[model samples]
Target: MITIIAAIANNHVLGKNNQLIWHLPADLKRFKLTTTGHTVIMGRKTFESLGN
Candidate 1:
């Protein structure tokens, strides 16, 4: 199964200034649970943004 996860704005916006514009604790928790024990994949920019 291939699932793409991302946080998008209500205005249909994605990011601003190369950074996420929204922060939700519940979403973060869900993200962790969804990716746990899974081989997560992300774009180079996403990894860089995470300071990896």
Candidate 2:
């Protein structure tokens, strides 16, 4: 199964200045649970934005 998951606001604005504007812990938990044990792919910018 191929599922595309995204967190977007009503305005369809993804991010500003390559950074997320809001912090949602619940969303993060859900994302972790959903993609657990699966190979997730993301762009370079996205990967870099989520720093280690």
List residue ranges in candidate 2 displaced over 4 A. none
Could you give the C-alpha RMSD of every candidate to the true structure, in order shown?
1.8, 1.4
Per-candidate TM-scores read 0.70, 0.80
lDDT of 1 by residue, 1-52 (tens): 8999978778989888877788788987998899999998987887787673
> lDDT tens digits, residues 1-52, model 2?
8889887888998788887667899988998899889988988998887688
Mark the 10 consecutive residues where model 2 has the least summed lDDT: 14-23
Model 1, position 15: C-alpha lDDT score: 86
Model 2, CA-based lDDT: 0.85
Candidate number achieving the greatest lDDT relative to the actual structure = 2
Q: What are the Cα lDDT values of the candidates?
A: 0.84, 0.85
Looking at candidate 1, what is the lDDT of residue 42? Answer: 84
